[model samples]
Target: MSYSYTIQQHVYSFPDLKSVLAKASPFRTGDALSGLAAESNMERVAAQFVLSEIALKDFLNEAFIPYEEDEVTRLIMDTHDNVAFQEISGFTVGGLRNWLLSHEVDSQKLAKIAKALTPEMVAAVSKLMRNQDLISVAQKCEVITQFRNTIGKKGHLSVRLQPNHPTDDLRGVAASIVDGLLYGSGDAVIGINPVTDSVDIVGDQLKMMDEIRQRFDIPTQICVLCHLTTSLELLDKSPVDLVFQSIGGTEKTNASFGINLSMLQEAYEGTLQLNRGTLGNNLMYFETGQGSSLSANAHWGVDQQTCETRAYAVARHFNPLLVNSVVGFIGPEYLYDGKQITRAGLEDHFCGKLMGLPMGMDVCYTNHAEADQDDMDNLLTLLGVAGCNFIMGVPGSDDVMLNYQSTSFHDALYVRKVLNKKPAPEFETWLHNMGILDDTGNRLTIEPSHRLLKNL
Candidate 1:
């Protein structure tokens, strides 16, 4: 069946739902590079108009990657809540949008319908939303997850203390961690992206961070951002607080990264057996980004943002402790500039939170991209208001190992201070105990001669 609407005698037709979704998406170079973007701005408007008329259940019947060929699609179909979907069974995409934005809809109401909604449905609705609309609705939906520390509670924010080093230098990485901790970062987790994916290096890094965490008795977790296979190999021999992997939107895309649904489940279960978390057991950490499918030639003709939404389904299935989009890290090919990157960041956070994942963001960009610190400041501030679970806290806002610009220790402090958001509950207590945070837990009071330096 064809979908179309008319404007001033000009009939805009979409051959299929996929085409309609592709054209309706926000302007991004990756979609255009894939030849999936709207031909013109008017066509995009027409597509959005047609999409608004699409019924919510229409997405249930259509599979972008077909149920048989894609495991992600199959998981979506198998896990859908028919009973819960009945609540919105009669809604059009536009009607769902209106209902979502209404004053009556709050965090609890959205949570009830979250599992009933598919990623495509959420993604489709997201395209119809403005930047502020995304933020407003996301601000109302609270999806919290935890491991050793509570995160995603209202009025709280967390930072992944990313102390990445070019050579995986123990002392160098340790110094960065100290900086992050003193700055009241690392309430989320102290995650490191090693120069190599070597299991030995990953294990050693895990041990090093764990030792630091133990000496201070910090209430946060630590992870080495390596392949799930590497994590599994070293899980027992090393202190693996979290299992880390790079996931994507499609079966082929994930396969290109050497992961499948079963492998992910195995990694989840394997990490759970260690039982390392203090306050909770949520301990899988997965990272995703737009353009990953396009980069791997596995997007299957879908727009990059929609494909990104599908990756959220994977993260949601495992009940992950941390699910962050390395949004701008994929570079300008997928998200062309600060404008596009900012849009994608808001959209990812909105869609992920709606799909019931504890969403965070790596508010970052590459040096080659047409973005700078100012753009990041805008995105960070917006995400902070949107109640994003966490953001990356790299030293000096630059990753020596990954060689990209990201949020830093100071950035976290600025957002938290201006927005009146505090760190995770457990971490805030630790900071107060260490005298890094004042009695109110709103301001930091770092001491140069703190005992933490002696250990370092």
Candidate 2:
């Protein structure tokens, strides 16, 4: 399927799509209502346009256009006690889209409906939305902000120290943590991904991280991103601050990872049984991405992006501390290149935030993919603007075991500096007290003391 149009001597083809959005003007482009009907692929474009129009905030006096209400609208109205219709009487698809964009609608209310609304409806209204506008709605959306109280301390951004060693070598893991802490990273959680799935090995790694945290008197959490079953076995034997798992769009894909909602609840209950983290702090850390559904042959005709968003529904049910979309790690068959990866990253962050999860981006790429640091830099900036909760911090942006390049510890610092953000309050105070960061939470110029440099 394709839709083509010419504008200013440029011919643009909307591939895998079937409709073209017409520019808004005083004169009608066409009289047929069918002309405005959107195809699945046109949803993004239409949504973008509606968001852009709403950002203008000039639609108050204009009569909202009319369209038939479908199951999505009916469900939304019923769930919310018809407040949806009360807010926008005589609502049309176009009108509802505009109402969502307009300032008149409560962002929390909009988010509620947005989450309940079908993906097709969301795509239809949000097709033409600008990134900034998307960010605006996300800021007030309920789901995007729900986990805020439970994740980071003092409302500061957080970072995870994901030190992965090919052999699960405890010493190498210690070196990486030393590097991350010296650079003032891992304020979110000092987590490691063990190469071996053995419960004993992962249990040992968790003990190592706990030992380091206690040794340095650092105020931070610890986690080992082992399979859930391994994590479950180690619960009583180790100090697992947060249980880590990777979720996908389908039950089968999640099962392949040895997880499902029931297992997740079991982990949740088990974490509470151990009572490792601070009071009120959430104990689950989840990672997701597009294409996992298609990768597992369970997409069921839905686009990868949409399927990925639905996974957020599953995630929020558990009230996780961190839910990250490792946007570019899956490779090009799902997201073809840097541009595609960048767009999906932004979309995933936006959707996750809208759904009320503390979102982070593992801004990264594989060696064979059509992406680079420049692309990651671009995504890093966008996700920051979108109010991302935290991000991954490797020593030099390269994970030797995972064999991929992601944002480095320094990259997190740069974004914090550029955006005037700080790490979680408790960690920030620790850094300042230790002279690793200044009062403003900026990295200090103090030389690496022998205390930090000696072992390495």
Instruction: Tell me, by lDDT, which candidate is best.
Output: 1
lDDT of 1 at 266: 95
Error of 1 at 51 (Å): 0.3
Q: Write down the TM-score of every candidate.
A: 0.98, 0.78
Q: What are the per-residue Cα lDDT tens digits for candidate 2 across 281-385? A: 577889998778667765444456655765776676677888899988887666667887877777777777665677787998888778899999988887776
Give, for candidate 2, the lowest lDDT window spanning 10 residues: 25-34
Give the best candidate by TM-score: 1
What tens digits encode model 1's per-residue C-alpha lDDT throughout 203-287? 8899999999999999999999899999999978999999988999899999999999999999999889999988889998889
Q: Alpha carbon lDDT of residue 357, candidate 2?
A: 72
- Candidate 2 regions exceeding 4 Å error are 1-97, 104-128, 140-155, 446-450, 453-456
lDDT of 1 at 209: 92
TM-score of 1: 0.98
